[model samples]
Target: MKPTGTLPLRAGLGLKPEHYQNALDAAEKAAGGGLWFEVHPENYMIDGGPRLAWLDAIAERYPLSLHGVGLSLGGPEKPDEAHLARLKKLVDRYNPASVSEHVAWSRLGSTYFADLLPPPPTRQTLQTLGDHIARTQDYLGRQILVENPALYLSLQGDISMVQLYVEAAQMAGAGLLFDLNNIYVCAHNVGGSTQDWLEAVPADQVGEIHLAGYTAQDREGDEVLIDSHGAPISGAVWALYESFITDAGPKPTLIERDENIPPFDELMKEAGQANTIMDSVARDRQYG
Candidate 1:
């Protein structure tokens, strides 16, 4: 199997169309050298258009990463052939430094859901997920990173959710795109310790890390953490990120914001914060 693409150990933001010009401008400035950008491949799976043109221009400036949300990698059926074809085209064209998808599935039969639905964690599901991830990697001719899904409810399984995630990636010779925010949300929504996820996942196998924000809602009398990528990174999640980075060193980290979009500079600021932690880690390693 082809090796997964490599990304600079730097911070990236989820590219938004509104920030295209800013991104291009930043790329030219010395300040943007450490910045990279990731996009949902589903947005650029097109023939030709102004959007594709913008992406082309951006690709020329900074290293790119494709974070896909529609692969349904954990779904029952095989990945859609047509989607893979379109994705492969973009992969070949841009040669993104990384390509990743969530462990959740969003499709069933001919119907599709707009949300990243969590899959049950059973041995059968593990086998299915491993097969799906392997097939996805084989078809794309490149290894891909599979992210853990955000959980809202607990389900019975022979193995723990974290185990399923890490083992499946190992089984398929793929990497893990550990989303720290998701784990934080899971700990609140279901019931577990984020440390369990941090310890369960092998740091060397982590190709990338995602740091996003979640919202809390008062459902009935209790509060729940929602993986709503619409707020600033919380102090708790930031602490979690720092703890992990201190031990694991740095990986290609991303600041993801998909709703209530903020100014480009604001997103860049968050990226800078992540860069700071990574920078600290780099400094420690150098001195030690």
Candidate 2:
């Protein structure tokens, strides 16, 4: 369900287990926190634990965005009922400011994969994706933003990935979680213009933006970019982020670092940088 509570038009960081106490302290220090925090939701799906308790404390002090990684919205199968029930409980418990899922599948029957695999962007796939998203929203009684996947290889399809992404969200009356690092990685790893993605995306549909870092690796004696959330935001992705907000206006941006997690202060530094960019855009809009 679409959350009635809203996040600040500033920056947020993905909350990690290591930084729970620090996040609580930070959230308590600032008013409305100016900064918000996101989580995988899957981590807190279990009942009555220290992790869930920590999240409860943080949610009370600051706005939370539940960025789910499961549910496999891009798959042919409908969302798992058990998963939806747990997610809905979280939604009801926290009343998060925003909720989101990905445009990739990670499950086949009872077996789950470690990676989020992208689906072909054909008409049939689009229909399945849209139906799944709609069903998820219906079950939760709120809308969700669907994130685009980081593609390693271009799949054959009738429509473009961008088209499939935007259309699926529109079909479900949902929002977009635009990930700048993913697109940057896609362009470098596969082939596409980041500008084309920017041009194709509707600014109004974008409820949140994600900024992260990618790593370069050797594969088959060639260079490939991996969407590794281990390092600081790259200059290229940061430039793309600035360009996006400058043109599309500001959205709730997130410094999404998951793997090789850094210190809380370092993540906050990235979030502060996002705020600086948003502030610049706001000032330009007022003065320009």
Candidate 3:
């Protein structure tokens, strides 16, 4: 297998099926620099199909990141062997700049859940997750990034979630995919400081950053923010993202919108906004 390389420090868009043609055109015009795209590997895990063909055509033009949603690394059992094999195939085929999976679990025995459920951040759970991540890296022959999940309900984890992620990455020799929207949603829902969590992240270990839209609703006589990548990014999330970029420097950032898909131009506009922030930060660092 080819060695995984670092993604360019620029803005990327989540590659949705609807935007395939536009992504390809943009990539071609960009000549494979200054932009990148990420996709859920599960969507293209097929024997033979037009989807894979579309990915092939696009991969030829732009750098790609394989963001896995079904690894279930934090589950009680080991990472599913079959699922890992499928992921390995995709990784080998694409040789993405990065490969990432959620720090949350979504599988129990043979049954799979649609949602990426948060794992209890206990010491024992941490060790299990670390072991699983190590095994996954060994299997793929490359380090994989673990992403923070959006939590809805509280759990009885002994350690703070940030500490859990830090320790997990250190234990497994992996990197982090910092989803800023998730942090905002989690902090608002659970009552904590988003900036504190952002400050706690080890800058050197962050491989990528994600920005997306979220929704707020009243539930049980209180308001909660849901990490729904359906609408445009909120102003508060944008502020948090700018703060993070200014502190951590620029990482390969992504604009994720999985639901309520908009026109390709609109998605690019959001990606462009991210690029503007990144460029402004870079300029400040360069001049100062």
**Top-lDDT structure, candidate number:** 1
Tens digits of per-residue lDDT for model 3, 1-288 = 223438889888899999888888876677446788899999999998899999999888788999999988888999999999999999889888999999899999789997899899899888999999889999999998889888887788788877778789789899998999999899988767787788888888899998999988898888888898999999988998899899778889999999999998898888889889988998999997
Regions of model 3 farther than 4 Å from truth: 1-5, 31-33
- Model 1: how far residue 230 lies from native, Å: 0.1
TM-scores of the candidates are 0.98, 0.97, 0.96
List candidate 2 segments past 4 Å from native: 1-5
Each model's RMSD to truth, in Å? 1.0, 1.3, 1.6
lDDT of 3: 0.88
**What tens-digit string does per-residue lDDT give for candidate 2 at 71-113?**
9999879999999999999999998999999999988899878
Looking at model 1, the pairs that clash are none
Better of 1 and 3 by TM-score: 1
Candidate 1 residues 1-288, lDDT tens each?
767647889888999998999999897786797688999999998789899999999999899999899989888999999999999999999998888998998999998898899888988889999999999999999999999988988888898999889988889999999999999999988898999999998999999999899988998977888899999999999999999999999999999998888999999999989999999998999997
TM-score of 3: 0.96
lDDT rank, highest first?
Answer: 1, 2, 3
Any idea how many clashes model 3 has?
A: 0
| Candidate 3 C-alpha error for residue 161, in Å | 1.1
* Regions more than 4 Å wrong, model 1: none
